[model samples]
Target: MNQDSKNKERHQGRSFTNETLFLKDLVGFQRIKYRYVNVLGMLAGLLIVVQAWALSNLFAGLVSFNTLSFFMLILGLLAWLLRSVLHLIRDLIASEASRNIRFNLRKKLLSELTFLGPKRSVIDEDAALSTRVYEQVDALDDYYSRYKPQTFMVTVVPFIILLTVLPISLITFFIFLLTAPLVIFFMVLVGHKAANANRKQFSVLAMLSNQFMDMNQGLSELRRLSRVKDARERLSSSAKAYQSTSMGVLRLAFLSTATLELFASLSIAMVALYLGLGLLEKLPWQLGSSPVTLTNAFFLLLLAPEFYLPLRQLGQDYHAKQKAEAAASGILQILEASTSDSSTTQVHLKDSETPQTLMLFDSLSLDANKRTRLVSISGHIHEGERIWLSGESGVGKSSLLYILLGFEDSYRGQCLIDGIDIKQADLSQWRSRLAWIPQSPEWINGTIRQNLTLGLSNLDSASIHDALEKSKANIFIKKLPNGLDTKLSELGTGLSGGQMQRLSIARALLSNADVWLLDEPCASLDQETAEAVLETINRVSEQKTLLVVSHDTHPIEWVDKHWKLTKEGLYEVA
Candidate 1:
């Protein structure tokens, strides 16, 4: 690649990372803040202070063990009840935050998918996109919200308590201070390696997930061919891989935890042993009237366990934290993927009768690694200039459709609108002016009108009914009990191939696009039906530019022109 190309790629890669990973980092910090402060925080602070004081006095044996000491200890223990209540509240808050953050992040990721929908054809397939959206995105999101904040809290509050405890007693302070760092270091050495493996597994699982979803989406076709079971087995293997890698990470987490616990226990014992010797040597160094005694030793020992509690929990928290970071890194890689332009640009559609054509594509060609579609394609379409594209299957007709829509940018040649580079033209504006009808219209399970509208609004019933009737889509639609409002399955189970094609066209017509790109609009229809649909296209293209890609079938019996696909490129057919 040239220096300019490499620089552009780098710039885009950086932007994508910034946009995608910021969500997790932002959510993680905010979650910690919300849980750590407020009324609950104040109570935890108060409990720690009183607990510290009680243990100190108990070791001094200033109060009698009979009733006074027991009474004070009981009061301090009860005040510590706030810790339990705080835990419960933290869990409740953490649960909600996790769910919300996950939901929002997933939603954002899905929206970005839509934004990049056109450019996706440059990749091998949309299957990867689907997995990124439905599966991997969710897994990574779960880690972000659930265990992430816990990790932060474990890292934060424990360190704070360590500092607070150090001023009180050097022996107790050294025990936790020395051990916590070891836990983190040990976890990094072992768990970090596992995290790398988990990350690799996630990538393969993502690939397998996309393939499986693709296979499932095509299940009907696979079912006829008896390949459904094969697909299932394939997906099962991917699932197994994901499970084993995840298990490996979890196992490392457990081991790291065990090692941390062992070290903490040993440290506390050493502290206790040191204190026990100090008490035995109490008479050697008497301070005025009182010498340190067994009571004081017992009291310090009692305080020792609780001191280690905060620091020891770090081991467990480290595991959750490492896993979350691993998941976040995966998502971050995708989000940070560099694209040509990440900024939003606006370019509106041009009206047919408008003096200056708003958008134009002169000798446009799209080249991609997808499905061996178009090669060195070049064409021009103006408002009122209807065209048909004929090509062999797997020659990238659909890929070409995506290129015209400004999705794939890997192709050569410039696309101009009104003599301006479409590359710099606002994409959102350009897309707003387009209406597309795929060979198989997506039949989401919804009311007939919803299917017809595709949830895109603002079409009066007259325009909608007219488009449906002309496209031959209204026949089955009107037969339904609710007419346009009839409910349909996800793939329009009750509707035939022809009905699906027409409804999808109606949805596109509703978009009121200035340019229409159709791929095999009449592929599954009979001679008469295909002719009728062509007639509809002819009518629609009168005030709009229409680009059609198909094999033998040509829509618009009187299309303005037809372009035949050649091995080298596109050429106008006489």
Candidate 2:
């Protein structure tokens, strides 16, 4: 079988104890907050018992034509009010705890993605990560706010009611004792199936989310290829599959609830039958007399359903537990995988120290998907030198830039900066001294000013205008109605390809990094615009290092040296 199937089988086979342990570990300090919620639940349970007792006594007094005790009436009302207040407080605490936990988990997930950088895409699809961060994390809400505390309530509340019932009548107590296990039995029996269905539902949801995201992202391409129909059919199939799994989960949930209700109703009926016969003084056995008094019989009858209430609620929350387990599997997969990988050391470069030489030795190679991309390559580039790197498509030119950016760590041999292996240095600190411009620059839906100054601060207006003019983007900015304040849609919509590229160059110029890695920087520009941008780049980077990767030969004219990458290795074309 394939790896995904194997993983699914393993996840399904995981024991309940193991799944609970995983969820508890995620709860972290939030577990302490649950302790307080549980205490409130216990208090609520006691109040429920008190309220039931007082009401039973008052009702028996009325039936017997005795004067009602105003004190018992007052006591019952107070208990009910206090119980409601406790429930409100408990819910508030649990909701806050759930919110905080989700927030912290999302934060950790984001940090992991940031640390993984470009390599994160290799591990999982963006759509899958997005689903985990938003929907799957949300699935834990019911688990924390309801199911977790109900677990304790199911044990404590029922036991308290049983204590109240046992002293009143042994027959009622035995009935409670015998029938309670049946409800729990069927709950567990149906719960196993529900858990499996929930996991399948989560799996289908992630698949559906990924498929939809892919279709949305590539909708333009699909239209161009006249394959939109095919894409739609596939998406429809995934949606249908998701619907099937979701219905299966709901059916099981209803089945579990019905099973619990059937058992609980029968148990309550059995208690009522015993209490009615005893109250009528119609004992079936040769016992001296009916031990059940009117007050006692009424109290036992009142408390019977309350005894099973926690168990019934627990049966309902069992589904939430299943959902949380499924969601936690996805969440823990990302968290645990990040921890298992070998991480870069925390060695930081001195602020006063700048890399003067970059060296590669000992047959540096990069392999991806079991195919060699870079083979036995050795090279060096000194500071303040503009090198033009030329290679055909699929020759690992972009991969080399990825390695220097600390985004690819699977490369063999050493990439050193001024005698320090780049792998050993803190990547954030290392990347701070370098700027990268990819073929297609990324932008958010915001004003042009925000896009330009992203992750930067304390820039004066003069500096911003200077970078804009140097990159020749100021010419277009002047024509726009809002200038730099112009709001662009996602991916810099409303801007031409050349305009977007110029903005990227202008942003890089503002960074003032010592090393600049440009991949097809002028690919989107016309010949005239390309030369203007390249000229600005050459002038600005004269004192810094430049490693420009291009398929075209035009950029070679102004470079200090030229490097060609072939299947064998990288070679200097002097």
Candidate 3:
């Protein structure tokens, strides 16, 4: 095959895989609830047949015998009410199932993100990730609540109607069987195109969302650079692209609905024609007489539309299935990326009464893009040692800290703590023993107390005050209105860089972990502030093992030893 054919084949394969994954998740998440939805659907189908039979009998009694049967009328009304009730029940069950599925899916996505941590950059764009977690997950609501149950109804309800029709008129049954395929044929033909269109629409939506988020986050920079107009124009272009693709999907949906309706109408019309002719004794046959009675004719005519109801509904819901498949593709990619490496051992790292020692035996790290981040280098940090590690820009100084913090594990060689290789140890337990203070600290839009005591319970007032004083953040924090109870904006927007850094240090101090991994902790501070922060860190971390990666020489005097990292290897600076 040529290149175009090969590409088409690959695309088709990917679509199929996405569809399979969606089905697996649907069944796996709420198998019992989904089964109940189908059971209700089947019961409703029987009720539909009963309602049609009663209505047909009621009409036949009035037309043929010139007499009204109140019994038939009551039976028909009761069946109709029961069928409606069944439908309502099915919808309620499906809706609950859909909500539960979305909840579990979001939880899994969040867990994966938490597990990956900094390595979640492999997911490409943060905006795209948010879209998957929110928008894409919401798109599956209709698939689970409507399309899934409808699929079962289309299969079971039509068969029940067929069995009812077979005894009344063979010709109607044959027409039902044969004409059903045409509707399905057109549905499949249109649906293939709709599926591709939905996927494209979702892709464009993700790109547009990512671009909009990026622009929004950097609006100040755009204005300062005099590129606000350019950003606006680019955003407008993406919006137009998304609009075009969305219109394409809507067009395919309309076309599929119309096609199914045309075929369904023609088939129902044919059924009506046959029933009318037989009732008038006009059907072409050797006997030249109607084989179907007046009551049976009424029954067949009343049941004709019911036969295609499921098929029509299925066509309408096919678009939802397509949307869900597209969304599942993105979600599954993230979940799969999280579990791709399950070979890592789960041995829990037990906390030792003695101080812990960290050893690196030629540890190396490769980034998500397969680029060498940390070269083959080996070193050891004894307990209670405050080592200052200096390296040039892009020399993997932060990468080394990430490896020790249990965030980046795509490395060769061993990172051992107390003779236990970290790769083989439980990351959750290992991380619980380490305190990490990144160069750019992050805080949620919550009270300062919440940010400081995150995940650390039972921190009394004295402990909080002690931690803040030790990090030199108490003076600034005390001046703020409401003190620690004062709320801060996202990323600590109300505070200066130095204050945020100090608060981060205080938060780390509150963790009371045995090891401290400080990645350029003072990089954002001035000379005086940096010196103060380093001095505070040295005093507080006197009994803890500290590995501080910085380019400044302020920590050189206080640190036990200074190590310099180069492309060649890690070396001690005498």
TM-score of each: 0.80, 0.85, 0.90
Clashing pairs in 3: none
Please give the lDDT score at residue 309 for candidate 2: 92
- What lDDT does candidate 2 reach at residue 445? 84
- Per-residue lDDT tens digits for candidate 2, residues 1-574, read 4333323432332333466787776677788889899999999999988998899889988989778989899999999999999999999999989999889888877766666566677657878888888898999999988988898999999899888877777788898899988988999999889888988887888888889888887788899999999999999999999999999999999999999999999999988988777766676782556678888888888889899998999999898998888888887766654322243345656553454565454567899779988876888887777889998888888888877887666788988765677677666667888988888787878999998899999988999999998888999999999999999866676788778888888898889887899999877777887787788778777777889999864555889889998898888887
The number of the candidate with the highest TM-score is: 3
Candidate number with the higher TM-score (1 or 3): 3
For every model shown, the clashing-pair count is 17, 0, 0
Candidate 2 wrongly placed segments (more than 4 Å): 1-19, 167-171, 207-241, 280-288, 337-345, 350-355, 359-377, 388-399, 408-412, 520-536, 550-557, 560-574
Worst 10 residues of 2 by lDDT: 6-15
For candidate 1, the TM-score is 0.80
Between candidates 1 and 3, which one is better according to lDDT? 3
lDDT of each: 0.64, 0.82, 0.81
